[model samples]
Target: MPNYSEKPTIIFDMDGTLLDLAYDDFIWNELLPIRYAEQHQCSLEQSKQTLFSFYQQHNHTLKWYSSRFWTSQVGVDVLAMQIEQKAKVAKREGCIELLTYLKENGYPIWLATNADYAGLQFKLEETGLRDFFDVIVSSETLGHAKEFIEFWQILASKHPFDAKNCYFIDDTEKVLNGAKLFGIEQLYSIQQPSSAKAPRETCNYPMLSALTDLIPILEAQTTEQAEEQKKYA
Candidate 1:
C-alpha cells in the first residue's frame, strides 16, 4: 500500500541496510578486539570483554560512532582496520537493484548512518555505493548518533523532508525508534543484516528480507500516478 509515486524521501542506513553487516561485525567483535589484545599485551577474550564494556558506556552516543574518539581511547587506528577489511565489504541482496529503481523513479535517496565519516568513506569506496546517494549524513558530522532525537531534528533543519512522507530502512531498532519518535510514518527493519548470521527474532516494525521485495509495490504506485497524471492532463 506504500506509494512511491509520492516521491517520498527514502533514507537508508549504510551498514546492514544497503551493505552487508558482516564486515562491521567482524571489525568490532573480532578484528578490533584482536588488535586491542595485541596493543595491550592482553589475552583476546579479556580484551574483547574490556573493549565491549568500554563501548557500552558510550553506546547510543556520538562517541559510539566517532573514530577519533575511539582511536584516542583505544590507542588503535580504527580507520586502518576498516580499510584493511575493505575486501569484506559487499552490497546486501537487492541493494543495488533497489537503489537503481529509486534513482530511476526520481525518489530522493539519502544515506543516513551512525557510522563515522572515515568508516562511511571506507564502505562507500569499497562498495562503490557513493554515487547512489543524494546526501550522506554521518553521526560524526552531526555530533549525535542516529539513535538520538537531536540527530533527526538537526537533519530536518538541514534537509527538510516531511517525516510522514519519508521511508526509512535500518537494521537497528534503536535508530528506527528514534525516527519514529521524530514522526516518520514508514519505518522498516532489515531481518538479516549479516549474511553470515541467521535472521534475528522478529521486531515490532515490519521487516524486509530483501529490498527488492518492495519493487513491485513501488512500480505499481508509479504506474498509477502516471496514469492519473495523464488523465488530468
Candidate 2:
C-alpha cells in the first residue's frame, strides 16, 4: 500500500465528474424548451431561442446553477422538474469504485460543485453518495460559481485546504482554469461530461476517460513521491 498521507485531497465536481451529466442535459435542453413553449404560448423554436439567449447571458454565473433563478427566469419549476425525473439521476462509470478506493485508502475527499444546495441535497440523496465524501459544498452557499477565482478563495477560506496539494477534476475548461488561476497545481477534466456528447480529443489539462483512470495516476504519483523522498533521505 502507498503512504496514505501523501495522497492529495481529491476534489470533485458533482454533475459531470461523479454523476452522469446526460440527465442535466435532458432537463435543460430538451424538456425545458417544451415547458417554456407551453408556458409562454409560443412556438417551440421561439421558446428555445428565448431560453438560449438567457442561458448565454448567465452561462457561468451563480444564477445559471440555481434552480430558483432558472425557475423565475424561465417560468418553469426546474427543481420540481428534476425531482419528477429523479430516477434518471445516475453515477458515472466507475464512480463508486474510484470513490471507494479513495475512501478506503484514507485520502481526503471533497465535492465542490456549481450546483445549488437544494439541487445538491436531492442528488446526493438519490445517489446515496453522501457518506463517501469528507466535505460537500455547493456554490449556492458560497455565493460564487466555480468559474471564478473568488469561488476557490471562498472555498479555501471556509475549508482550509492546501491549493498546491489537492487535485480538482471538473468537466468545464473555464472552471479548471479558475482553479489553475487560484494556484491549484493538479487539475483534470472529463473527456465526456455527457455520454450523449462526443468525447473530447483535447483539453489544456489531462482528461479522465473514466473515473477509474484516476486510481492508476494516484498510484504512480505515490511511486514517484517515494523515490523522491528516498533520494533526499
Candidate 3:
C-alpha cells in the first residue's frame, strides 16, 4: 500500500492501464491489415504478413506509435481508421471508479503513454477519459518511446515529480522496467491488459487484475493521512 503524507503524483499509462487494449489490438492487427489489403488489392494474409513485418522492424522505435509515419508507410488514413473504430474503445472495468476515487481524494493524476497524440485524442474522446487526467504526456510529443531512459528524463524535466513518491502503473513490463531503471520507486503491472486475452504470467513487480483492487489500499492510505493530519493539528 502507498501512503504519502505529501500526496504523491499518480502517473498512469493510457492504453492498457486505464483503457482496454482490445481496441488497439483490433486496430493494428485486424482493422489496419483489412484496410491495407483493400488499398493494395492484396489478400488479407499477404497484407497481414507485410504489415507485421513492418511492425517487427519498428517495434520499439518512435515510428511504431506515430500515426503520421504509419499513414505514409501504409498508404492509408491511420487516424481516420482509428476514428472509425472508436466505438470499440472502452474503459477497463473498475477504472472509472478508481479514477473517481483518486480525483475525489485530490491526487494529482497524470496519463503518460506511448500512444501517438492523434490516437490518444481519439481514444480519450471516445472514452471520455480526457477530463479525468491532470496532464497527459505522449511519446510523440517527446520523440521517444516509453522503453527508453531518455523518455523518463525528459518527462521529469518537463513535469517535475518525485520519482520515489510517484506511482506508475503500466501493463508492459518493458515500460515498467524503464521507469524502474529511471528510479521510480513504486511500479505496478496489469495482469490482463486486453480483456479478451488471458492473464499474463506474473511480472517482477506487483500485478493488478483490475484498478478496483487498489481501492481498499487507497482508502486505507486516506485514513492514515487523515490521522496523521489530526496528530499534527
- The 10 consecutive residues of candidate 1 with the worst lDDT sum are 1-10
Taken over the whole model, the C-alpha lDDT of each candidate is 0.88, 0.93, 0.89
Better of 1 and 3 by TM-score: 3
TM-score of 1: 0.91
Question: Alpha-carbon error at 88 in model 1, in Å?
Answer: 0.9
Ranking by TM-score: 2, 3, 1
User: Which candidate gets the maximum TM-score versus the true structure?
Assistant: 2
Indicate which candidate wins on lDDT.
Answer: 2
Candidate 2 deviates by what RMSD?
2.2
lDDT of 2 by residue, 1-233 (tens): 43434668899999988999999999999999999999999999999999899999999999999999999988999999999999999999999999999999889999999999999999999999999999999999999898999999999999999887799999999999999999999999999989889998999999999999999999988888888777656
What would the TM-scores of all predictions be?
A: 0.91, 0.96, 0.92
- Cα deviation at 233, candidate 2, in Å, is 3.9
Off by over 4 Å in 3: 1-4, 219-233
Candidate 1 ranges beyond 4 A from true positions: 1-6, 220-233
Better structure of 1 and 2 per lDDT:
2
